[model samples]
Target chain A: MKAMQGYCGFLGLLVSALLVGFLAVLFTLVWVVHYREGLGWDGGSQEFNWHPVLTVTGFVFIQGLAIIVYRLPWTWKCSKLLMKFIHAGLNTIALILAIISLVAVFDFHNTKNIPNMYSLHSWIGLIAVIFYTSQLLLGFLTFLLPCTPPALRAFIMPIHVYSGLLIFGTVIAAVLTGVTEKLIFTLKNPAYSTLPPEGIFVNTLGILILVFGAVVFWIVTRPQWKRPTEPNAKLLQPNGSTPEGTDYSITGDFGNVDKSDEDGEAAARKRNLKLDEVGQRSTM
Target chain B: MKAMQGYCGFLGLLVSALLVGFLAVLFTLVWVVHYREGLGWDGGSQEFNWHPVLTVTGFVFIQGLAIIVYRLPWTWKCSKLLMKFIHAGLNTIALILAIISLVAVFDFHNTKNIPNMYSLHSWIGLIAVIFYTSQLLLGFLTFLLPCTPPALRAFIMPIHVYSGLLIFGTVIAAVLTGVTEKLIFTLKNPAYSTLPPEGIFVNTLGILILVFGAVVFWIVTRPQWKRPTEPNAKLLQPNGSTPEGTDYSITGDFGNVDKSDEDGEAAARKRNLKLDEVGQRSTM
Candidate 1:
């Protein structure tokens, strides 16, 4: 009964995240296409439109899903290794779209002979992209590669999770600033201060983006929602003790055992053994 | 040795957070006083300057310090009740300043006949303030009051922490958008896109705010940095089983026994007993 309730709560939140995320993308499209010029690569303001569209779609929405992939209860039955691949693949796609969006802005600016990277939005957006790239590379090297040491992977896991969420928040900040800058520049006649339809629509879009981020962060941080350790995996402590609530299996080293299909008492026994090891080491 | 290393890390991050936070406030002051018309209430744009100044100092910096107050290593020996009061007091101050900031913007708009709550920045900023107020009230009723049930406190703890961080991120988003809007409107002579001195200074200020946020989030989330369970507090299980690594003593119910200054074997035995209870409950 408890499991069923948890599933319902997770499903409700997941649906809300998707609905809000979809609305964010839809609003951006309507604002850019119907309200402004449709997207293009002709080195015009139309090219710059791709910046917002791609950012909301890829950087904000897709990256958010990647962060919470492990918390999806349905995915719990899958091998941790397979889940890591899915996580990495999603992040890589988000990065590619982000790069293209960055290119769109620069191209439009250079063609119009306008200076770039002067505004706070541009500075923050550039920094977020740089950090995203570093996080992806480090995550891939530490978790994806089988050659990495378990101790090293354990050491990097918390730092990796911390930076991932930080970058997500930074992306949301950049998006909000970019939207404000674009509206202030384009809405001169109506004046964003006067609250035109386009202004109201995009403001709703920003709220949706913020809401999506909040939902994703909640899912990722919930202790109850963490992925369970693999049934037969050996739990290794990096600093002679495992911190509470951390699942070392996240590092993708399941040791030499392959009792993946084990169930009932055997699985319970393995888990107990892991706890006893933690207890003994912590006391020492 | 490990304890010393942990303390050093905590100190370094705390110092970095303070430095960046100070720089953010200083830049905001310089941008407003030296570059703009300075602070005033003459129904001019100058009246709006108080919005950024107060939001950066109170909403962003002080609220951030309040969030991490429990993580201070030196304060681990302090009574958790005293710490709760400190945390609540800091948040209350932040809320008061935030309310004043809101009033400044609204008064400026009303006096100047400008439409209010029109842009994305206003929408998100208002929502963040509303959430902060609700969070503060809920935290006080549950944590500071002696009448609240222990089980209820345990249930609300995670949600409280989650919403606190979420609101902080929302505030940063609002600040960044507000900065962008102000720059676009005010930098008309050379234009914001021209990379003027004032623009660059404020841009750096935005970066400092982001870094400060990143550092605070890091300190709060590190599992190693959590306040230890009280030396003599009884471990209570909220849901028949305790989730891994969670210290239930955070609910502020130390039970009828007061062993606040107990040391040596008795402390170790109490800690071990808590672990054993957790182990036993999990296997059930």
Candidate 2:
């Protein structure tokens, strides 16, 4: 188990770094290589460029990073509430970017007199975005809110986790479909069949996106990779002890109460193992 | 939890049925609608039609079914070895079909003097096949072979599970890319942008494929959906006691000995719970 942990620790960081780098390259490929005319909300075909650029940045990259936040070892010492806020914040940014990207696509289509939502990619992409928005809102209400009862939190937690991962997968699928659509639609000189540099880069980007999704999902879902609660974890501040301007938590909801429960369980299990070891030693 | 199980069971069945129906529809779309010229190994464009037809049949549908075989409720009553054989058999068939599909693609490209592995779809699809083949061989060595030590099996099992899911997702992404490529490539008169009936049907098929992939992943990964082990499960036949022509097991490796250890743990826990209940009743 120790060896496995060591392996995952190194591997997870390498993959995460690669994922981020790939996102940057993907952004550059679309924005810098293809749309050198520069981005604007009202420009001609240049406006359409934001659809891929922001979607990759906010939806694919940010959303993926958000999913793996819990598995990040560096963040293990951070407050769970703070981590939750960070997760929600990143997703919120992704959502805002996605919405704007959708606007860009719609605006471009309207300007060009092209049909809207004509492709399978559009249909699934729209669904993914809607699902993501709802997921975020529900997650915020259930997890971040203090008024949420423990029973409700427990009941909804599993579904939230499952839905989050599913939506991430859905988003990646949407991006692949979108990229394919764009490449096939735009490339005509050498044809996509000839495998031009742009086509190759786009294809590599798609593959990297898929790779990033797989790595993120693997890291998030592996049971042994989940962050362990610290035994001496500190309690959150009491009621009316909100962190300065932040109004999210009014009470010590993220306190040591939950941690102590888990810590007690762990301590009991450890004591039982020690007793077993002593018994074995005596017999020997 | 019982309600959750009920929900998952019904949902799994519904999704599985829909997946099969979608695959049939996808086949009908390509073979019946687009390629009414009929399928032949030596025909020109007709041979190209087999690329999509066989891929959807073997790579997508059969592979998916193989992934979820353990989750099927009806299969719980079957012998573990028999289920393993069924799982391996379906995958073997899927692998054969995938190889044949690859041959068809290469053959068509060769006959037309078209370049091979040019598109992003082909690259990802080929990689998926390679990964799937390797995963199958490794799984066979670790699980089916009696020579594999228990420690090795324990170490490899989690990785096998993770890789299986990753490959399934990769294949789905490849399929989406392929469908997008074909729709863009084949439709000329109306063009894919016009969304003709064939284009519409093809897009819907792609969407259905995505839905099927999502459903299969959900069913396969959910802990509650896993088939429960029977408490009184029978042991595999001992050496020279193999059933009929089967010779894989030289010992009762699939026997109930391991299960008894788990059952004993459960019984001890139950006894502790009962003692606490009795003490509480007396105090009350």
What tens digits encode model 1's per-residue C-alpha lDDT throughout A9-43? Answer: 76689899889888899999998999999999999
Top DockQ: which candidate number?
A: 1
Off by over 4 Å in 1: A235-284, B235-284
Q: What C-alpha lDDT values do all the predictions have?
A: 0.76, 0.66
Q: Residue by residue across B90-166, what tens digits does model 1's lDDT show?
A: 99999999999999999998998889999889999999999999999999888878888765766677678778888
DockQ for each numbered candidate: 0.29, 0.17
| Segments of candidate 2 deviating more than 4 angstroms | A1-27, A34-38, A229-284, B1-38, B229-284
- Tens-digit lDDT track of model 2 for A146-259: 787644664566467657877888888888888888887887887878988877878878777887787776566543334443323213423222222121111111111122
Estimate, for each residue in B91-159, the C-alpha lDDT of model 2 and write its tens digit.
999899999989988998999988888777888898999999998998788778878765466456656
Per-residue lDDT of B55 in model 1: 96
Q: What docking class should model 1 receive?
A: acceptable
